[model samples]
Target: MNRTDRLLAIVLELQGKKTIRAEELAARFETSVRTIYRDMQALSEANVPIIGAPGQGYSLMEGYFLPPLSFTASEAVTLLAGAEFVQKKLEPNYGVHAESSKAKIEAVLPEQVRLEAEQVRATMRFFSAREAEGSRRERENMELLRQAMLDKRKIRFHYAKTTGPVLQRESTRVVAPYGLAHIQGAWMLVAACDLRRDIRHFRLSRMSGLEETSDSYELPPDFNLEAYRPRDDRELKVILLADPDIADRVRESDIYYIDAFEEHPDGLQIKLRVRRMEDILYWVLSWGADVTVLEPESLRSRVVKEAQKLLERY
Candidate 1:
């Protein structure tokens, strides 16, 4: 980038972080340390209020702030697209804020840039594939859970547990809601389950009659939602041979647990890793004769048994 842009970016970077070493800035901008020193000197001359300590690195003065900056057409389009996603995917409250944000951004943009951004954004669309009823319910649940989390209150809800294609059981749970996450187009709540005495994930679609309780609690200092990752011990391997005609379709389905796909002389070899036989049982059944299980005799037997059951029902 040009020196002017580099200087502006340096100030912005300083504004973001508490302190950064000269070597770090040099690597970030892809320039030599000597050049970075010269740039720092130039910034100081321009009265940018950059403070440098011998051991500590460079930082902006406490009260220093940047003036309003202009956005490029591409940048405006990106922001607008994000706002569009929020409007379509998130709860009603966020949708309103997203709409207002878009309006404010558009109001400040240059006419030419705004028009350009509009043209680009016109080619894109965002919509949920979920049924309207289901989507609305999840959004409502999300809104309630979000408020409960913010207010440091516990929540009570009825959650249904599913095994394979069948509903296993339903139970009421009172949990200290921690955070919400959207994964695979579904909303999940991560919370400390009072009954289980451990952290658990609850799918919003499976939740009903959610209500905030009068009880309040504090978030644990060691718990961080952003860094939390559930451990999965899906060691069961299931291999399938798919007919060439359906191989592409199977791949297109984007099954989350698929480990690898290989070319087989007969057709395609698809390897799957799952936590339980039930995890893949229904999916295998869905393909009918087009997919054949080649390993794990237990899964094969289960598939045959389910197929026999289907035949008996017919």
Candidate 2:
């Protein structure tokens, strides 16, 4: 951006990495070494504890760590604490780096701050600590799928659906593999399920024997996962207000996450990207009065009719 912004970015770069050469920083920011040297001086004058051999660039002083954006006391507690929490969520092989980095963080925190962090550490609860499925296979299928998706090569896989038996499938549709996401502590794969005639999301653990075919295809120019997704609001636009306390209940439900409620002043308003009125009605009815359905007269009618049925049974 501007010269002032560039100088600060240089300091942040050094703080983030163990060490960086002046020439490397200069090249990255498109500035001369002389300019970088001047920026280093400006940093030092501002009490930014940057120190290293001139040729080696710089390193944050082990004794002096800078909190991101000069954090206030509680803010500092939140940051280091958040990092510690993430240490548990990550798969271990990658978490070694996180662990070593956490060690440095704890080393630099004042004793009181570190103690406060520990108090938090003792109280957090994880529902399921079992090692997740596809803890290993996911990494393998991902790489193969990534190549096939990008080069637009066809893929063959033995995939098992949520409700039925395993099946073999292949198609000429372009495959676009997006990143892996963790949901309910399980890994899910978001990719175009070629035979499904649209973008599809699959649990990685459900896919087996993924094989890339030798043909390459072009992705139709207008394909988007968001647009292709199924909605659960019928043909009507159904918005909903969910109870704040009922959030966990919603998450625990078997409803697919085509779109979901986000908390707002109107409460947690969930949008159903795909229609499933029978399903959504059952979902709302399960919550009782804790959730209020809004919009779409059709959905309201279904809920009302279901409530009548339930009352009759009672």
Q: Report the number of the highest-TM-score candidate.
A: 1
Per-structure clash totals for the candidates: 0, 10
Question: In model 2, where is the ten-residue run with the lowest total lDDT?
Answer: 162-171
What are the lDDT figures for the candidates, one per model? 0.91, 0.66
Clashing pairs in 2: 230-274, 231-273, 231-274, 231-275, 232-274, 232-275, 232-276, 233-275, 234-275, 261-270
| Per-residue lDDT of model 2, residues 101-120, tens digit only | 77877777777877777677
* 47 Cα displacement, candidate 1 (Å): 4.7
Clashing pairs in 1: none
Off by over 4 Å in 2: 1-10, 13-88, 123-126, 129-156, 163-176, 183-186, 196-198, 210-273, 277-314
lDDT of 1 by residue, 155-264 (tens): 99999998766987999999999998888778899999999998899989889999999999898999899999987778999999999999899989877789999999
Candidate 2 scores a C-alpha RMSD against the true structure in Å of 9.7
